[model samples]
Structure formats: C-alpha cells, structure tokens
Target chain A: MEYRGAPQATLVDLLDRVLERGLVLDADIVICLAGVPLIGLRLRAALAGMETMTKYGLMQDWDREVRAGAQSLQKGAALLAGQAVQPGLH
Target chain B: MMEDRSQGQVQEQARPEGAGGEAGLYVYCIGPALGGGCCGVTGIEGREVDAVVHRGLSALVHPCPVQPYQTANLEVTASWVQAHHRVVEAAWKQWGTVLPLSFNTIIRPEGGLSAADALRMWLEHEEGALQAKLDALRGKAEYSFQVFWDPVVIGRQVAEASPDVKRLEEEVQSKPRGLAYMYRQRLEKLLREGMEARAAQECRELYGRVARCAERVHVSRPKEGQEGQVMLLNLSCLVSTGMVAALEAEADGLSGREGFSVRFVGPFPPYSFC
Candidate 1:
C-alpha cells in the first residue's frame, strides 16, 4: 500500500518504463536499433544474470567450500588410520 | 515548418567538429521550451545534457557516439537506464510536464542534416500533437499498480466456494487409495479452473475501483510473482497529482484484503501515457 518512489527497490518498475514505454520518434530521424525485442532480450538476460548472482551464486560458492572442507576432513581421517597401521607394522 | 537557421549549430554544440566520429544526439525527453537550459543536468556517460529548442518545445539531449548504449555488463546497462531516468525526472520537475523518450533514443544526423537540425525539424512538424500530449499530461504522473495474490489461499477459498470442488474433495476422501489419488488430481484441476474464474472476477472488480481514481489506465502483462504469490493484475495508471491520495487509498483497501498484496509505486513522468 505504500506509494514507493523510484529507488533501488523499484528498479524493475523503472526499467519497465524507461526501456519500454516512452514517446517514440519518426524512424527516419531516430537511430532505430533492431527493435524492442532485441533490447528487451538483452535487458532480460542482464537482469536474470543479476538475479542469479544475488540468489544462487553465493550459495553455490558456499556449497563448494563445504564440500572441500569435508574432503579435507576425510583426508585427515585416512592419514590418522595410516599412522595407526604404520605403528603396528613397525 | 521553420527554416534551418543554424545549420551547424547542433553539431558544433553537441560535439566538436572533426571529432572524427559519427556522433548522434541522445534525447532523453521533450518539454515546453522554457528559454532557460536544463539546469546543467548530466546524462549517460556523464555527458552534459542540454535542450534543442524549436517553436516552444525542447528536446533534452546529450551528445554520444552513433551506437546505441548497450552492454553485456548488467551494472553498466543499469547505470545508463538509471541516468536516463534521472535526467527525465529532473526535466519533469523543472518543466512541470514532459514527454519522456525511451532509453537509448538517439537522434542521428540524416543526409546533409545535422542530428540537432533533424530533431528541431521533427519537433516543429510534431509541435501541435506534442503540445497537445504535453497539455493533456501536464498535471499527471504515471503510477505502477500490481496486485499479487497468495495462490494457496485463493485455491483454498475456491475449493470451499465451489460445490463441485467440495464434492470431489469428499469423493477423494472416501475412495480407495489408488482411486483417491486420481480423484485428487481431478479435484485439483477443478479447483484450478475455479481459481482462474475467481481471479478474473477479482481483476475486473479491482480494475473498476482503481480506474475510478485515475485519469487513464493501461493494463500491462502481469509477471511471475515471488515465493508463493501469483501476479493477478499489473497496471500503469496516469493519475493527476492531486488524485494520488485517492489512488493510494484504493491500493490500501486492496492490500488490506486477506490473501492479496499490492505494489503501488510512482509519480513517474507519464512514460506510459506518452
């Protein structure tokens, strides 16, 4: 219900207006890019990339770190077992 | 149409002669020619933004290379978009009314005509229409209104409201395990249909209420909602500045309803209206 202004919180709404809705000029004078579809695709990709980074990128990195830690723990356990066996052989 | 008095003025003022590149005038928005320049606002890439005037209208512009401002970098693109919006917002505040151009709207110089001249001539030709639009949008701003509903809640309500769905729910409960599974799927489908119908009715009622508070309403495609919510209505409303409170009051009422949430943002420079 709060009437939000154009801040970072409303970037999606701002982009919708700035990218899609506005006064269009005659084709002859304006430097027309391919069209809205192309621009929309590019912006959507960029935004999707950003969302992925914010939402899952950190979690993926954390998952890797946790797996590495577990691997190191396993290696330590193997090393301790090897030491225990070496003493028995000696 | 006015004669082109300043043949090289746009080129000279927008960019340095023999700058050895094809540069174009990137227009942000257009407003009534108020004589005084654009309060020294800077636009994309920190380029100084000024106005190209023609018969009581001005197009706020900055000089840039002929290429569109685009990039693979999300941050860069976002910055450009934000800068474009900032300039337009500034113009809107200063000029009292403006017709905002989409992002990266660059006016390139045509054959034998400088970009600035092309802009000026276009403005002259479109003066009547542009002025009419600006007049119509003078005291209004565009607002974004989106309604998201909790699908789980709406689905439950639909199930309780529809007799068919209630009967199926009871049948599913009474049937054998395997048959009950099949009945559950059928029940879900029926509930989904009821939900869609209910959603349509809610949308119509909400649109009617919100439309009354605004001068103009543009229905936009609803987007996917976050978490468990589903977007029901997305609208861009052109509301007179004085009527913003009334619009907010309506939004507040909608948001207060159980299972429904509203996103009402703006006072934007009538971008959709344009």
Candidate 2:
C-alpha cells in the first residue's frame, strides 16, 4: 500500500516468492505467459492442485517449473543468436 | 569520429580513414518524459549530448546506427555501455536525480513518440522507486558496519552453546542412529540461532552508536557468496557528507571488539535511498 519501501514489483514479488509459494523459474513459466494472459491461472491451479507435497513432490514441482524456465531461456538465447545473423535486426 | 583534424592529423595521414560520423548520439536511458527530444549532457563529457527533455524530465540519449547491435561479441556494445556509464556516473556525482535504465535501449526510426508513451509508464514506476529511497534517506549519507566472527569466537561460542558435547563422549558412545539424527538437527538450529543472535546484537549496538550521529539508518544484508558471515549493518546519516569520517571513526570504536569489524563506502549515488 505505502510506496515508501523498495520498488514494489521487484522487492514485493521477490519477498512474496521467497516466503510464500517460493521462487518461480523465470524462463520456463513466464515465457509462455509473455503473450498469454493465462500464466497466472495455469500456475495458480497447478500449485493449488498439487496432490501430495512430500519432499519428493515438492522437488518434482520445482523441477517442472525450472524446466519450463529453462525452455524459455533457450528460446531467448535462440532469438538473440538469430539476431546475431540478421544484419538488419542488429 | 572525424574531428576538425586538429594540426591536420586526418589531412597529414597518408591514407585517411573513412570520415567518422559526428552524426552519432548517445542514449543515456529512456524514461517517460523524453517525448519532446533529449536535453543532452552539457559540460561534463565535452560533447553536447542532451536528453529528450519533456514533461519536466528527459532521457539523455545519443542516436546510433542499428547495424552494430547485431555483433555477437561485445564490440560496438562496449562503446554504448561506456557512454551510458559516463552519464550515470556524472549524474550521481553532480547530484541530479536520474533513473538509470539498463544498456542499449534504442528507438526504431520514427518510433520515439510511441516509445515515450510506454516510457511514461516505466519511468513513473522507476521514478517512484527512486523517490521512495530518496525520501527514506533525504538528508542522510550511508554508513556500513560489518562484523565477522573470529574463528576462535565462533568455535568457542558454539562449543559453549552445545549441550550435546557431554553426550558426544558419554551417553552417545555407540552413536545411536536415532539420537544422532536428533542431536544433529538441534545442533544445527542452535548453531544457526547463536550466530544470528550475535549478528543481531551487533546491529543494535551499531545502530545505537550511530543514531546520535545520523538522522536515520537503513540496514541492508551483505551480498551473498562471500565466505564470512558478512553481517553488515548499513546506516544512512543525514548529516553533511563531511561527517562521514567521524561517523566511520565512531563506528570503528563500537566495532572494535575481537570478532567485529567495520567499513564505510559512500557519498554514493544514494542507491540505498532509491
């Protein structure tokens, strides 16, 4: 509510990520959501619907999110690499 | 890069290189107010590069050809980075409020106007962040106090806290699996809590010492990855920058205990406030 602290988006999001549901894999999850408005709904449902949360289950979810982030990062990397070849895009 | 060929450096050369574009411009950062045109940096950099001064603010930028951005290695990229850094560094030193954008933001041909609309949203957000930090430390200069535990201190302290050492030799002689597991968990928690308590105690002590000398203090965690417990207690003192050394000396007096240490870095860009 008060804007006196650190920038809301960076700090609030980071703290929320740390204390609550924990960190999100940026690359995997957000890339798909970049053009889609559904990232929140999909991610929220997946997390809320988690059937069991044994340590292993927790790790599995972590892995899935990280894998998605990795995929997103790969896409960005490829785009950057493609930009390297395109004289016009430079 | 062609100059007026001072003393005929360009003219005297047997093979003159291609004329460099005096046409180039450097872009400092893009924020909302840049709709009109840049109000170039005036005296510091020797060039007349200006900001796109609009809405009572501006983005100091330079125009550049789009071709070089495609390079894979960081060649043309380096020049832009250096130029931007120069502006930012000067602005920080000169005491102007600026929101630094990450490197290499460019306007597509004729897209500067559209860029301003988006820029407005972003600049407003970052500007709010800047103003918050500014207000937080309005008259203050930052001070940092760090305390690192001497290995001897950590060992002695943890050794004193652990009740299991007696059990280590006497009751747990056989290393019972169940008890050992419980013992390790408790030990870890105790050790962590002990270290944290000491760190907290030091922060309070440091805060007390400097509260007299400073208008306000804002603490921050030491950056991660360093080995030492890097317990840093940051403070922003509203006194003139002239008081920095005295504050450091005062901090040094308080931090002089065996396991504690103190250092100060600033008159900086007011990053903590921002």
Candidate 3:
C-alpha cells in the first residue's frame, strides 16, 4: 500500500492518553509549592466524551447530575402533557 | 491507588531539606539498554535531559524542581503536554522501542532515599514486568481511527426508508396545527432512534474491518459537542509497525464512502497498550 504519509498523532490525542493511560508507578514523592503539592491539574472536563470520561473514572459526579437532570425534565414534560407517566420512553 | 492519583493533585512534600540543590526526576520512558548517544531532547519547561541506568534498563529523565507540572490554564497545559510527548517521540525515534510514562510523572526522594536512589529502587522492583512490556511492544506502534457521519444525511435516509415516519409526515400535513405538533415530535423521536440504530450497525462493521490489521484494539468514547456530526467510532489499535501503512489505506477506503469522515493517526508509542 502506498501510504499517504498522514500525520500520526495530534496534541489533542496525545494529551488525552498521556496522563490518563500508560505505565505509572505509585512510589512518587510530592513536591510542595507555596504549601501545596505541585501536582499538575488534569483538565479532563475540557476533553473526552461523557462515556470516555466515565470509563476512565474522571467525571462520575457530573455524569450523575446530567442523568438526574434529564430524568426530571422528562417527568416535567409528562406532567405538562396531563398524562400518567409511561413506563419508559417510546 | 496509582490510577486514582491520575487526576488528583500529587501532594508529596519532601522531608525537610536533607539534600540541598537536589532536583526531582521528571521521567519520560524506560527502555532496554542502548549505546551511549544522547537523545538531546529537552524535557517539559526546557530542562536538561538524560537517562539514569540501572541493571539492564535505562530511564529517560530530566532534573526539575520537585513540583509536578500543573497549570489551571489549558493553553499552558497544552504546551506542557506537547513538550512531554516530544521527548517520548525523540526517545522512540532514537531508541526504537520505549515504555512510555504518563505525563506529570515526577519522582522525588522518599523514605530516606534520594531521588536517584528512589528511582533505581523502583526500577529494580519492576524490572521483570517492565522488561516484559518492553519486549512485547518492541516492534509495535499505536494508531488511532475516528469515524463520523453527517447526522442530517443519516436523518434524511432514515426518513426515506421508514414507512412509519413517512406516514407521520403525511398526518402532520393533514392535521390541524395543535395535534400535528405531537405527530412531529413522535416523528422526530423515531428518526433519532433510527439514526442511532444505524450508527450502531455501522460502528460494528467498521470495527470488524479495522480489526483485521490490529494486534489489539482499544475503543474510546466519541467526544461530545459536534452539533450535526454523528461519530460512529473512536478507537486505537496496536499493530505491527509494518502494518501501519495498510491501516491507513483502509481508513482512506472508509473515508471514500459517502457521508463517512475517517481520521487516522499515529505510529505513536502504544500509550493505550502500556
């Protein structure tokens, strides 16, 4: 196959996996900067789908809140329709 | 515990200054022994970089302040992440195969051990597992494939094919405005479900096609927030370095099909595999 020479990885993909996946060791010492350990902030909220974030155990709380909100919205719509709640969405 | 710390702050304070001027180690990757030619790659924040060898393994590292790289701002974080990957890429280019470490992996001296001693101790402890991973991944690389379809086009196709949806459309045209609204809602929901079912089938077919060239596959969830584009698959595959070309060719073939947008990337260190 004549390879079209496409660029293999981009910064988004690299950043997504670099800290989230890969071989990590537990024997790490903490570095304190201004009385706080200088461990980096992982901005996972800015990347990944809800499914991916949940798979990696990053955003379960947010996921729960979203689900709950959706459920309530559905219930409110059903009430507005003047109908008893159906067993499930059709 | 290591997995839990992935997103949390690494708050390890060094026991009161026992060794002055000692810097923490920022690790990039570990690999089998290699001949002495410096990679000359810079670490995050332009630190000097080199390797620390013990037994038969070499750890590519650079000395930095004991603190881990952290920034609330994303732009700076991106640069840090980019710099981290650059080192790994350089190591892979020079060393052939490396066991890549995740970003922000910093090891400081703990339990009365200096930073170098701590690293050496960990290397000794994990030597067997590390070596096995390294050997297994020697000639393999990770590739990413993403498949997307235009939702509008899919909805149109679903509308054309589903007789129920077509009947509803006619009912809406005939009914008064109030009742017609409910029919429209039903039709919209039906079309959405139809599109999802079609997408699921397409995803299975694409995965089967791509899996032919893969040694191992890791399926990731599609990122949210595409207004009209429906993602079908987001996956990473570990393939023999030799098969990367074939995978890209397959991706090209998939992209050529109507309404499908395929993105293929990599030859990267097998981050998912590791």
Q: Every model's Cα RMSD, please?
A: 16.5, 17.7, 10.1
Q: For model 1, how does the per-residue alpha-carbon lDDT over B87-196 read when each residue is reduced to its tens digit? A: 99999998889999888788888888889998888898999999999999998988888887776776778778889988888888789999999998888678656766
Once model 1 is optimally superposed onto the true structure by TM-score, how far is the C-alpha of residue B18 displaced, in angstroms? 10
Worst 10 residues of 3 chain B by lDDT: B8-17
Which lDDT tens digits does candidate 2 get at residues B1-274? 1232222233322222234322223344333342433333442225455555544445565544331122211112223334444565455444434444333333323234333343343345456543454345434443333333343355456557667643443454466889977776665555555555555555566567776666555544332111232333434444446666677677556556655554444443333333
- For model 1, what is the error of residue B10's alpha carbon versus the real structure, in angstroms, after optimal superposition? 30
Winner by DockQ? 3
Which ranking of candidates, highest TM-score first?
A: 1, 3, 2
lDDT for B253 in candidate 1 is 89
Candidate scoring better on DockQ of 2 and 3: 3
Error of 3 at A39 (Å): 6.9
Write out the backbone clash pairs for model 1.
none
What fnat does each of the candidate structures reach?
Answer: 0.38, 0.00, 0.34
> lDDT winner among the candidates?
1
Model 1 CAPRI rating: incorrect
Every candidate's DockQ is: 0.15, 0.02, 0.18
lDDT of 3 by residue, B1-274 (tens): 3443343323322223335444688788888878564477787768677788889888888876565666443445656777778888788778778888877677887888877778888889989988998889888988888776665666678889999999999889999989999998898888867766676667767787888889988887654213334446778899997887788788888777666677687778888888
| TM-scores vs. true structure, each candidate | 0.81, 0.43, 0.76
Better of 2 and 3 by TM-score: 3
Of the pair 2 and 3, which is ahead by lDDT? 3
